[model samples]
Target: MAFLIKRGSKKYPYITARVRAMKSKLMPREVYPKLMNMDIPEITRLMGESEYKQDVDELAQKYSGLDLLEHALNQNLARTYRKLLRISKDEPNYLITEYLRHWDIWNIKTILRGKYYGAPAQEIMDAVVAAGQLGYRQITSIANMESIEDIKSALANSPYYSAIADYEGGELSTIENELDKIYYSRLLASIGKSKGEKLSLKFIMTEIDLKNLKTLFRTKKAGLDKDVILELLIPGGMELKSRDLKKMSSLSWSDFLKRLEDYSYWSAISEVVSEDMTSLMDVEAVLDKYAIEYASKVSHYYPISILPIYDYMLRKNNEINSIRTIVRGKKVNLPDEIIRKHLVM
Candidate 1:
C-alpha cells in the first residue's frame, strides 16, 4: 500500500461512477457454488481466468495448493483495497481511508494474537494485510518486534496505541476488543454535520449493531458470564443498545433465543440459534449475509455518496473470505455440507 500522494478533487459523482464500474467487475455470487464443486487446481485455473489471474499467475511457480491460494488472495485483497485509496479523491479518499483502517486494526490484532500464540514473525506477516494507514514496511517492523511493549512503543505516537495500554499479556481478546471499540468510536467521532456524513454514521451504527450481535452470539454460545459479554460489547449500535444487550446477556441459552424475538434481526438468526448447536458458524454466516445484503440494498438509494464505496468494500472483503473459506475447507477435506453452511453467499 502506498501513501496518499496528491489530494485530488472531492468528486463523489465522478468517484462513484468509477466505483460502480469496479464493483461490477467483482466476482458474482453465483460463481462460488461452482468453485466449490471443483478441486484446488481446478479452482486455481478458474480464478486465473478472473480478476485474481495476475496474482495467481505471478505466484504460481513459487507456491502450490493452499499456500498458492492464500498468498494470491492476500496479495489481491491488499492491492485491491490500496487501489481504492489510490483512485479516490479528497472527501471520498478520506472516508475510504478512515473505513479501511479497520484492516489496520485487523493487522494489529493478528500481530498480537500471533505473538500470544507463539507464532513466528514470518507467520505473522502472512496474515498482515497492509491496506490501511500502516504500510508493509511499518507492519513488518512491528511484527518483528521482540515484545508487545516494543509494539506499543513503536505505535506510541499513533491514535491506536491507547488500545495497547494496560496490557498484562493475559487476555489478548480484551485488547482486541478495545482496538475495535476505538476504531468505531473514532470513526463515529469523525462524522460531521453534513447530510452525507449522517447517512454514513447511520450505516456505521448499523454495522456496530451487527458486530455487537456477533459478539453476543459467540459469548452467549460459550455460556460465558453476563459481565464478560457486556465488557466485550461496543457502544453506539443503531438498535442493539448496550442496556438492552446487558439484559439479554444475562439470560440462559434457551431464554436468549426467546429474548431475541424482541429485536428485528431475530429472523435472520432464529433458525441457527437453537439450544443444541455446537458451533456458531451458521449464525455468524447469517449475520454476514444480513450485513452485506443490507449494504447492497441501501447503497442504491444513495448512489452518489460514500454508501456505494462502503458497499463495494464489504463485498470485496466477502469475496476474499468466502473464497478462502471454501478453499481451506476443501483442502482439509471438510464436508461440503458443513462448508456450505459457513458460506455467506
Candidate 2:
C-alpha cells in the first residue's frame, strides 16, 4: 500500500482517532457468552446480523454453513487490515504494514504445508490472506506453484529467501522455524527504524517471548535434548534468555513450573500447572490473556499514537478467531462448554 502523506508528515492523531472509533464498533465482549450457546445455524444467523454482514452476504451465494462463516471471517480480517493500511500515512503506515507482514510469514508456511500435503492450488490459495507486503499476484504465484522448492525459487530475491536458503532441502519444520526467526528479526528491525516506538516494540517483544516459552514447554514435554531445544529458540525475548530457556528445557516439568512461578507470568500460569501436568493449551490461554491485557494497557497509555491501532488490530483478530472457534465447534456438534473454553474472550 502507498502512503497518503510524504516524509516529515505527522498524521498520528487523526489516524489514531479513526482507529479508536473503529475499535468502538467491535463486537462487544458480552456477546460471546450468548454466542457460545448457539448452534451452527444460529451462530451463522447472528454473524449475518452483525458487522460481518457484508462479508457474509458476499460469500453466502457460493458457500454455506461453517465454510461460509470461515470465508467471511477471513475476508473481514483482510478487509479491515486493508482499510487500516489505506488510511494510514508516513510512520504510522510503515509500522502498521510491518506488523501485518507476520501474515506473509503465515502465508508462506501455509503454502509449504499445502505443497507437502499435495493440497490443491485453489485450497492453498484460499488459505492466503494477502495482508502482508506480498501482493495478490505474488501469493497467487506461490500458491499456483507445484512444489515447495518452486515457491522458494519464486521468492528468491526477497529477504524471505535468506531464511530458507540455509535450510534448502532440509526438514519442513526446520524451514518453518527459520521463517519464524526471520519474521521476528524483521519485526524488531522495523521497530528500530521508528524512533520512540517503545510501546510497539514492547508488544512485539512480548509476542516473541510467548512464542519462545510455548516452544520451550512443548519441547520439554516431548523430551527433546537441551541443545536441540536451544537451537530452536528464537532470540530477542524480553524475559527469557536463550541460555535460560536451554536450562528450562532440561528441567523436569515441575521444576520448570517452579521457575516460572518466580516470574510475572506465574500469576496466570500457576493455576494450570500441577503434578499431572497442564495441557499446552492451558499455558497458551494464560499467555493469550496476558497479551491482550498488555495491549489494552498500551493503547490507553498512548492514546494518540500507533499503539491504539495495533491494539485494535489484535482485539479484532481475537474476535475473528473466537467466532471461527465457535463456528468450527458448532459445526462439529461440540458441547457449548467445550466451545466456550476455546474462545480467547
Candidate 3:
C-alpha cells in the first residue's frame, strides 16, 4: 500500500496550464492510421510539418529516411522530459522526477538485453532514451562498458544497483523483473501526501495491476504452474491481491477464466480471451488500451493538480510510440490491419 508525504504544492496552476497548451499539439488516435499508408519519405514530410519540423530540417543534411526520423524523435523526447523537470517545482517535481526514472530503468534493461545477445553498442544506444536521471553521455558510457560487472560498478551508488547486484549473467528476465519491482517500490516510497496524491497512487497501482495481468497471461500461456507463476507476480496492485493471484493461478484454465470475470478488467478482455485462444497478444492489447483510457479519464477530475501533468506526459510519450510503430510497420511491409492492431491507442 502506497501513501504520500504531506507537503504544500507550488505552481500546479502554471504547470498544468502550460501542459494543456502542449497537449493541444499531440496527434489524436485517428491520425495514426493515415500515416500507416505513407512511405518513409511521405511520413518524413508529414513530420516536417509538425513540432518536429525544426529537428527534421536540422538533421536533414546529415541523415535521411528512418534514420533522420528516429534521431529527431529521440531528441524531442529527451527535450520534452527535461522541460517538464525544468518547469515544475516542489511535489510535482518530485513525482515527475521519480516517475521518469522509468526511462533509466528501461535503458538499463535494453543495455543488459543487448549485451547478453552480443548486439553492437550503437544498436543498444539506439534503444536508449536519455530522459531520466542518467544523461546521454552516462548511458553511452555504460553501453560501451566491457561487462555487466563493469556496469554494476558504475551504478553502485544508485537506487538500481541492488536490483542487479546479484546477477551473474543469469536469466535476464529475473533482473528485469527485479528492476520493475524496485522502480515502483521506490516511486511509492517517494510519493507525497497531497490532495492529488491519491490520484497518482491510483495511476501507479493500476499500472502494477495491468503489468501483473500481462504477466499472468504470458505465464498461463506457457503452462507455468501456480507456485512458479505466483513467484513472478508483483505485490502492491490496486486490486488482484497476491492471494487472488494465487487462487487464479492454481485453477484449471477454464476456471481461471471464470475467476477473472469477477474483476473490472474482465470486460476489456472477455471477447479475445478463451480456453481455445492460442495467443494473448490481443488480450494484452486490450489491457494496454484500458490503461491509456483510464489515465486520460481520471486526469480530468484534478485539472490543476498533478493528474493532468501525468496524463500529458503519457500522451506525449504514446504519440511518438504510435508514430514509430506506423513508420516501422510500413517499412517492413506489414499489413495495414496488423499495424493498426499493434497501435496502443
Clashing residue pairs in all predictions, respectively, total: 0, 0, 4
Q: Which of the numbered candidates is closest to the native, going by highest lDDT?
A: 1
lDDT of 3 at 256: 81
- Report the C-alpha lDDT of model 1 over 262-341, residue by residue, as the tens digit: 88898878877888888888888999999998888889888878898899889989999999999999989999998898
Can you write out model 3's per-residue Cα lDDT over 1-345, one digit (the tens) per residue? Answer: 223323344668889899999999888667787888788999999999998988888889988888889878887888899999999887788888988999999999999999899889988987788999999999999999979899999889889999899987857988888898899889888777677776788889888899999988888878898888887888888888777877877887788888899999998888889899987779877888888788888878778788888888888888888888888888889999888887888
Global lDDT of each model?
0.87, 0.81, 0.86
C-alpha lDDT (0 to 100) for residue 23 of candidate 2: 89
TM-score ranking from best candidate downward: 3, 1, 2
lDDT of each residue in 1-345, candidate 2, tens digit only: 246553333688889889989989999989988887777778888889999999999999999887788888888988899899999887889889889988888888888888778889878877777788887788888899875578778889877888776544435888888888998898888785453366678878878888888887788788788778887889888787666776787888778877887667678777876757756777777778778888889789877777888889989999988988877877778888777777787
Residue pairs with colliding backbones in model 2 are none
Put the candidates in lDDT order, highest first: 1, 3, 2
* lDDT-best of 1 and 3: 1
Question: Could you give me the TM-score of model 3 versus the true structure?
Answer: 0.93
Candidate 1 ranges beyond 4 A from true positions: 1-10
